[model samples]
Target chain A: MADEVILLDFPLSAFGMRVRIALAEKGVKYEYREEADFMKRIKSDLLLKMNPVHKKIPVLIHNGKPVCESLIIVQYIDEVWKDKSPWLPSDPYQRAQARFWTDFADKKIYGDSRSVWSTKGEEREAFLENFKVLEAELGDKPFFVSDTFGFADIALVTFYGWFYSIKTFGQFSIEAECPTIVAWAKRCMQRESIARTLPD
Target chain B: MADEVILLDFPLSAFGMRVRIALAEKGVKYEYREEADFMKRIKSDLLLKMNPVHKKIPVLIHNGKPVCESLIIVQYIDEVWKDKSPWLPSDPYQRAQARFWTDFADKKIYGDSRSVWSTKGEEREAFLENFKVLEAELGDKPFFVSDTFGFADIALVTFYGWFYSIKTFGQFSIEAECPTIVAWAKRCMQRESIARTLPD
Candidate 1:
């Protein structure tokens, strides 16, 4: 039987982008349902029903069962489609490391970026400093977990589309602050999966 | 060669209890180093070096490499000791569901519990209401993931000891609010792993 896969998402959400990238990476065909009035705080009934706990988008429904949380959904996609592009490393330790950095991106980078967007003056400065930590982690690597565009890369590069808005609102040049990270993001964009899935 | 495992933790921490529970479940012997001055904000050199990103407790060191984050550490332990009692479900869908509830427990339950502990008035009331949602999820399930005790159960049961403090500070009876949840927690407590590791 053919799989029925659907993603309930908002266009600009980095979380939503993660799921899109994972599905695309695996060459999995899925129905993309963008929440029209998501920003206006209007949630679709399907979104609410599928993810009653969070009532948030980026819920991946496979054969009618909903998987909430972006990374979890990405992992689900990877697991179900293991024959194709593997998002996580095969080694358990390396997998743990990938999860650690993906989590770091989720909690710190995404979180600090939001803080940078919302705050001003010293608070914003503190948040921007958090980005330097990410830059240090990125270093000269082509991707977050070495040469491969893996889980951490997918977790992070989704935010690349928002870099312009983040820089504009936060009044900072990401390229100037973290040139290598920007370069790595651009490298990731070369992939059809990422380029196609990530918002412009 | 025998594997060396070490857990740097604080005695009263619910997060630390999670690692203890996982290790105990696998019957993996390890050094349990309690961070005596953790509450005093003094981080050990080992803890700082091992988990510089978070620099927090419940850092599980397996053969000198560190895996921070309680749930991640638990997952790592499960993967490393796969031949032993499996903490995560074998099926991908079930694994994702376990992760979903585990994430929920981590984000919502843990966050709300802390809010209930720290706040007063309507804020505390709102946080307490969140527990009812958990109760509904618990329903008549023997554990968070039906008949077996798994990741979600481990993620949540660690906080059972803190329920007393949450109730005392927030002025609420969990048993009155969510009797089934309380019963489920007690059932988990029967396990030697949980009984030995969970804070008193």
Candidate 2:
């Protein structure tokens, strides 16, 4: 397509996968540039130039300008292509609740959950505390929302893929601690977009 | 102003200050309910019914429905009443950049900066690393954005206020390490809304 969006991302990156799923959901065609890892020092020159701070993948280049941050990119996509699947709820209160969950998933679940990859000690313990908070906050709710696949679902799904792929910290067993969240994650993955985009 | 919006918050909260400055910028009339710390702890009958999880302050109950999360509340305010001082920029790319900086200030600056409050060690070192990233990202730019005061400025001003107020990390002064950021903080403080909302 002449006007297809250009997504600069790696297939395995959960952050990049989120954008791919969003695009697929909206049925938007795009060019996908797989970026090499910086650990190997083989990433695209454009990516290096674009994201100097994080130098991370999942930089969505829509109409030539790059947008980083997976959640931010998702929101920008939703705003630009309004009313297709309606990622954000219409009611302001519901929308705020959605945003709170999205922020919670990003900052608390995905943000603090990364400590499993840390070297260990206080940092890992703090991350566990953070993860505990998410589990506590999630009581028995089927999803963060009353009934829907929305922004929060999108974010958590990304984290879920990470949890399974990493296979460390005994987190591969999401069933015992957070059954509801596990079920929710499964439900989100059942979608074709999610099923296709999830990393191996 | 019978139909005016209502803001439920406290000055001590950097989140609440975000809403306050946004309201003042828009010149919107509203009632400000100073939520008490005990009220937050005990979860007042009203707030408990309004915001269940993460029962923190900075809830803007506009036309009765509560919108929690300071940034979300600001966006809702901007969307609902857009005839006044625009919180978001016009161009899509510029707007995305503005949102990026706003989120960046929250995550990297405000969120990471809080580590400094803890006793010096790995956490403090991590905090300093985050600050260095901010310094590197923001070389000589007076504002996070190019020139104009936008979403990022509002977010940073809140952080500067809290960092200045907190005695826990009084030894680590921004004036000494981050002169540019300190100067920017001072420039932002000169704004009427910011100066007026000082915690007594």
Q: Kindly list the per-residue Cα lDDT of model 1 for residues A8-78, writing each as its tens digit.
A: 99887879988888888888898999763656988888888888888888899999888999999988888
lDDT of 1 at A37: 60
TM-score of the second chain in each model? Answer: 0.94, 0.86
Residue B104 alpha-carbon offset, candidate 2, angstroms: 1.3
After superposition, which runs of candidate 1 have C-alpha atoms over 4 Å from their true positions? B118-120
- Residue B64, candidate 2: Cα error in Å is 4.1
Clashes of each: 0, 0
TM-score of each model, paired residue for residue: 0.95, 0.75
lDDT of 1: 0.83
lDDT of 1 by residue, B88-117 (tens): 777899989889889888778877665676
Which prediction has the highest lDDT against the true structure? 1
